[model samples]
Target: MNVNEITPFIGLELSDASYEDLVRPEVWEQLVQGVQERELVVVRGIELTPQQQIDLAARLGEPVPFLISKYRHPEFEQIMISSNEMKDEKPIGVARVGNFWHQDSSFVADPAPYTMLHGVNVPGTSGHTKFANAADVYDRMPEEWKAKLSDRIGLHTVGKRLRIRQEHVGLSVAEFKALIDIEHPKVEHPVVCKDEYTGREYVYGSREYMDSVLGFDPNENEAFFTMLDGLIHDETHVYTHKWTPNDLVIWKTRTTYHIATEVEPGASRTVHRVSIETRRP
Candidate 1:
């Protein structure tokens, strides 16, 4: 197998290997280590069935099912389909997901540490995913910013996103609140978190889910977070991956934030995703 850096700091691309070659114990170990260190790893030139993808995820960590049942693969619950396809006038899978920068499962108490996606169908142009290395961003941040956020906690919730969706579907505010209270209550996590395996510190919140920084003046919270957002999303710290069929992309959740770009009109794209529970170091 040939390994290439997608960028100096953020991503690694492993090519010239098949799925069989990657599942070998030693190779798999190196692949996992590469993702933890580099933040994102893309394995090119290998097509995976839904079962194969789930099996590969299990080798890395426990493959957990997504919260939304509609997106789960019909045959395999662990595979969540992200597609713009339609079946019987309904979306076959969740469409236009992750259009904003965020970490997977951050609003939950036990966030998944790894997320893997296998591109099954991809557009010839204009459907790409962008990732930013939070660890790298944190490392270069101004000292005062680091000191201010070091001991801070962030309030995270699915409320904002859910509220928008509920409005589109005409759900009442009281009903929306009831649903959120049951399924996705607000949670808190450190603004700066350390990787258990590597001891690397990274900025841990995103505007998509993180509502505010605890103890900060409410009036000042927006400005404070906006400043952090600018630093976190600087283009120099980001790598954009153009999707291709058979590319299996994986990234460490605690170390990176990712967003999906717009797909071209009338273009078709489908990807299967799996989020793995925190793995032991």
Candidate 2:
């Protein structure tokens, strides 16, 4: 079937399902093509062994930048993302924590191009991520909203992006800021970004953080700002992924917004994260 026919089955998946291909041509398959403008593409049910995970990523595209290991495995570059409930990976990670939604590698120049995650150890209680499709969002937005967003250029800073990360890692806000500087133009892209491949558009920007910064003005546009966030949170446009053991999902950072759910006080969710570097920045 053409992509049009398959677009409707996006969020449906069977927890026990497994697949070999990076993207299945089936309706809900993770491998999607045809559009040059879609904001996000989620492939559910790709269970890869640690080695297979690396191989599969290589097949899909080039690998993205990863954090330098103060404490790294022999194959640190290929080491998938991981974490624990109580606290693990000491010395270096004595204070390490779970990751949050922000473009990957924003700490350095030319952050990762895409982020792909695979479930390693998922506690039954809580662990999931929510994604907002920027391309679809822009397509559905009012022309005026689109115009306003287009006219404005945004500033992305490592400091602001890491706010949620700090919170998730259980670090104090003061400590978080102390570790990272709020770098300028962390990514100065448009709020409404289009998918270079699919040519689709979506609203980009961390609403909570962006609005918080726009606290630049004492009189904030709280009401209007919130309404925009509501659009992404709306059931019709949002996809909440409840991860299962062995599930592998890949999304293009350029056109997708994802929130890696931090485990509640009692639960834990762990996964391997890899970023794909693109030819463009």
Work out the TM-score per prediction: 0.93, 0.69
- Candidate-wise lDDT, in order: 0.86, 0.54
Best candidate (score: lDDT): 1
The whole-model C-alpha lDDT of candidate 2 against the native structure comes to 0.54
lDDT of 2 by residue, 1-281 (tens): 11232245133233344444333445333343411234344444556776676665665567743554642223546554456523353432212333344434433445556666777777655667777665655676777766656646555555644435423487676856665544333455555666566555655565533523232343444543565666666666667777767776666665666665667775666677766665443
Q: Candidate 2: misplaced stretches above 4 Å?
A: 1-46, 68-74, 85-109, 161-186, 208-225, 279-281
RMSD in order of candidates: 2.3, 5.8
Pairs that clash in candidate 1: none
Q: How many residue pairs clash in model 2? A: 18
Compose the digit string of candidate 1's lDDT tens values, residues 99-137.
Answer: 888887788888888999999998858789999888887
lDDT for model 1, please.
Answer: 0.86
- Score residue 49 of candidate 2 by CA lDDT: 72
